[model samples]
Target: MKPNPISVVTFDLDDTLWAVRPVLLKAEDIVFDWLEEFAPKLTDRFTAKSFMKWRWDIYANYPELAHQISQLRTITVQLALEESGYSTAEAKTLADQAFEIFIEARHQVLPFETAIPMLETLKQHYRLGVLTNGNADIFRLALGQYFEFSFTAEQLNASKPLPEPFLAAQAHAAVNASEIIHIGDSLEHDVIGALDAGLHAIWFNPDDKEISADVTAKYHVNFYQVQCLSDIPAVIDTINKSRLHSRVTSP
Candidate 1:
């Protein structure tokens, strides 16, 4: 039996394509230093620990702001200033200036060595698209040409583990859910969300942690797992083969 041809392959950016945490940490440091220099009042509210905590607090407080990481950082800086007794207008200006410094210094990304080459290879065989929940301007990162379309939580107004964003990617890819495969690093958001949206999913588990029993059940129902980006092409090939076999077996 021949394998099923996978028409569309969608990916989550951030951790899936690159080592996001280190880049983000460095970016945050750059931002913090800028705040100290130009927005000293705002900087007073954020020690490294408090700044990290504030990020989650802000996310919880403004769920709609999840996809706008950059904007959220600005707002966080502004709010931190206000909390520390600055006037709203003062906070806004300081935060905006600090954020500009952060943005200019934040262009460095640590994409895995295999990521771009893998994309180059995969693009030849399948339609590629991005379904990230991040504010990383993928186009600015020079990855835009590899993808036929890209969707974000901001664009769809829905974040993963929700079906809306996944469906949005499907729409952008112009393919049915079953014909597309979604890949990403988060087991909860990427794997479960894509599965729920009726697409096959691949868990990009670079950390080698075992999926919990609870997650295993979810994974077994609709997804496969891969330890590295390098494994993706083989996984796609296997899926295509299985698809072909099933079709041949059908009446």
Candidate 2:
């Protein structure tokens, strides 16, 4: 019997496996409380909304740090502290401490009901990995047990909808593009990016968003869509059967 054509499966971390907004909001609140205690002067200077604006300004000024989430965030904290009158050395220390608090709280996510079961089944059949634009580490969460490897935009210095991240994942898996699949929630970053990079992509569109005809025409690649994580294994099986039939029927 022939082997399964699809051997590797990579996933996006944030919204694909679990809701990110609540976790991030909670993390921010925790960080704010910590800052209030440790750096009361900084909290006195800026509210969350204004601090975010400052961070965006920093991002605009240093485009090179755009993909480096951890660095960018640390720098944002350091600058905010300095602006609030801390000395440079003091700000740097506080920034690192603040980031540590934020990151720890960030990992307190509640996974979707189906995320683990879906990963459990998929891992038994294919090499599983992660490719995420966010800094959420799978190893920090329970889902870490399901993945063999992971790549992040911050680590690679490249974000998706650009081909480098996808290409890097394919290389790491030691598989041809056709033999790998990338599953994620974002159409532009995950679906279109993976398809453009010559890999099969499954859009984890739980929101039931419509993929317009113009998107297909613009990308010139077709992709699979699934509303439920549980449907993924069946989609991969369908992809394998279709590839097998194509091989047998092709000239």
Total colliding residue pairs, candidate 2: 0
| Candidate 2, superposed: residue stretches over 4 Å from native | 1-4, 219-221
Which residue runs of candidate 1 sit more than 4 Å off their true CA positions?
1-4, 44-46, 64-68
Tens digits of lDDT, candidate 1, 70-141: 777888878888887889999898889877777665657768888988899899999988888877667777
- Model 1 residue pairs with clashes: 3-240, 3-241, 4-240, 4-244
Candidate 1, residue 250: how far the Cα is off, in Å:
2.0
| TM-score of every prediction relative to native | 0.89, 0.95
Q: lDDT of all the models against the reference?
A: 0.81, 0.90
TM-score of 1: 0.89
Give candidate 1's total backbone clashes: 4
Question: What does candidate 2's lDDT look like per residue over 141-165, in tens digits?
Answer: 7789999999999888999978888
For candidate 1, the 10 contiguous residues with the lowest summed lDDT are: 1-10
